[model samples]
Target: MTQELGPLAREVAMSYYEDALPAHDRFHAKRVRDVSIRLANECDEPVDRDVLSAAAWLHDIGRPLERTNEIDDHDEWGAREAAALLEAEGVTSDRIEAVACCIRTHSIRSSSPEPETLEAKLLFDADKLDAVGARGLVRLACIVGERSGRTGERHAVIDDTSVFGTIASDQPDISLLRKWARERLDRLYTSPGRRLGESRWEFMEDFFAQFDAEIGVDGKR
Candidate 1:
C-alpha cells in the first residue's frame, strides 16, 4: 500500500514545502512518517498503515499556506488537502476519511476532536516526538534563526513564543529549551510514545544541566 501511495504523497508534500525552511521541509515530514510507522508496528492496537502513511505525509501540507495567512489553521487545511490527495489516488472513501481525521488532529496545539484512533495517536506522538531532545533543539534553532534574520543566535524569537511562555526576555535559552522539552514530555499519548519521550526528555534535561553548569548558571561552581 505504501509502495503505491508513498511516492504520490511525497511528491505533493514536497511541492508544498518547496519554499519552506529546512526545519519544516520534506526531511521533517519523512521523519514523522517513519516514526509513526515505527510506533504503529510496536503497538498492540490495530492501525491502518495506508491511512497512517497518507496522514503522516499530508499532516503539514497546510503549514505553508497558514504561514502566508491563506489559511487560518494548518491542521484543518491539511485535512482537506489530504482527503483530496487520497481521493485522487483512488483510496477508499472510508480510509480517506480516516486519513483526513488523523491529519486534522495531529497537532500538539489542537484541542477539539483529539486523536482517538490508534493511527491518529501514533501520528500525533510521532510528530511531537520530533520536537524534542537534540534534534528538536536544532529545529527550533533553525526557526529562530529564520525569524530573527540571524543565523544560529540560540535566542528565542519574540514573535514566536511557543516554548518560552511569558518569561522575561533575559531568561537563558537553555531554560526556554528545557521548558519546551518538559511540555512535550507531558503530552505523550501511546505507551511506546511515553517510553520514547522519557528517554528524549532525560536527554534534554541532561544536556541542559551540562549547559547550565558550563555557563555557571543556577549558581553552578
Candidate 2:
C-alpha cells in the first residue's frame, strides 16, 4: 500500500487481496489500521508507522489457508508469511521482524498480555477493537458473502453445516458469533477504544433487539 514497500512487495500485496480474503482479513484489518492510528496518538509510546501499519494490513495473510480460519493459532502463519512477503518487498530487517512479531502474537492464545512496544500496543489495541460492534458485524457479513452464504428463509442463523458455514465452526453458529462478540466487547484495552467502541456496541445491541422484536420471540404469534 506504499511506495516504500517497493514494487515487488506492492505487487505481492495486490496478489494477496485480488484472491478473496476472509472477512476479518479484508474489512477488519483496514478498520484496525484506522483505529491504530488514532490509538497511537493518544498513547505515551512511539509507534513505528511503517511497522505497525504494514503489520496491520498484512496480519491476516495466512487466514485464507487455515483449516478453521479461526483466530486460534493463526498469528504464526500470518507473521511468518507476512515477514516473507515484506522482506521480498525490501522492508528493513528490524522493522520486518517487529511487524511479524506483532502479527504472530495477535491471537488471544499467542498474544502477550502486555504490549512490548508502541507498535505492538497500537496493533494489539486496534485488532481487539475491531471485534467490538457495528463494524465487526458488517465485517462478518462480508465473510459470509465470500462463501456465497445464503441464510435459510431469508434470515435463518446459519452454522457450520450450512452451505457457507463459518470457518470458526468446527461448527459455527451465527448467533454464537454475536454472543462471542458481545463478550469480547468487554475486552477492549485502550482508553480511546473503550470510549469509541461503546456507542458502536450499543448500536448493535439496539439493532438486535429490534430484530428480535420483529422475529417475534418463540414465534408465539
Candidate 3:
C-alpha cells in the first residue's frame, strides 16, 4: 500500500518554502501544489498524495536559497534538496525515489526533460499552468518584483522577476500583448481543465479588455 502522507506533505512544504533568508517560500510551493492537485484531478490520474503533494510542495525548496543569483533556473536544485528532506522525513525509500523523480522534472524548459510517470507530467503541467492563467498573472508580478542582478549561489533559483513583475505593475514596456493571463486562461490541454479554466479565462479577458482599450492596444473606443 502506498502512503498518502497528507499532513506530512504540508509540513515538509512549510519547512522549505518558509525561508528566513529572503529565500522563496511556502506560498510558492503551495501554488505549485495547487496546480498539481488540479491537474491530477483533471487528468483522472492517480494522485500519489505522498509523491504529488511532496513534489508540488517541495518543487521550489531551493528558490529562496539561491546562490547563483540568476533566479531563472533552479529546478534541479529543488529536486536535490527535496530528496534530502523527504529522506529525512522517513518517507519510504520507493516513494521517496518517485517523489524525487517528479521533483527533478518539474521544470519543463530544462532542456525538455521527459516525465516518466503521470505524476511527473501532472506536476510539470500544473507548475506551467500557474504561469499562464490569472494565478500565473499574479505570480508573474511577483517574479518581476524579485528580479535582481546575477550573484554567486548554491541553490538554483528562478528569474521570473522581469516577466512576473511586469505583469503586476501593469507596465511591462511591451504593448499589444494579446496573449495575456486572460488570453491564456482559455487554453487547457485537458477537458476538465477547460471547464474550470475557461470561465476564469473569460473573466480575465473581460477584465483585461477594460484596460486594453484604454491603453489603445486594441484601438477601441
Best by TM-score: 1
By lDDT, the best candidate is 1
- Model 1 — TM-score against the truth? 0.83
lDDT of 2 at 200: 71
RMSD to native, candidate 2: 6.6
Better of 1 and 3 by TM-score: 1
Q: Give one digit per residue, the lDDT tens place, for model 1 in 91-119.
A: 77898789888988888774646898888
TM-score of each: 0.83, 0.71, 0.68
Is candidate 1 or 2 superior in TM-score? 1
Error of 3 at 103 (Å): 1.1
Q: What lDDT does each candidate get?
A: 0.76, 0.64, 0.60
Write one digit per residue (lDDT tens) for candidate 3, span 108-215.
453746777878767766665665546655665455445433343212222222533343542233222225443334333445555656655666566566644554
- What tens-digit string does per-residue lDDT give for candidate 2 at 1-221? 34654233334554455444556555566677778877777766556776777777777666655634454455777777778877776677887888877776665542434556667766776786676677677665655555545343233345324444334434444675476566655655667667776777788778677655674444323
Could you tell me the TM-score of candidate 3? Answer: 0.68
Model 3 lDDT-worst window of ten:
152-161
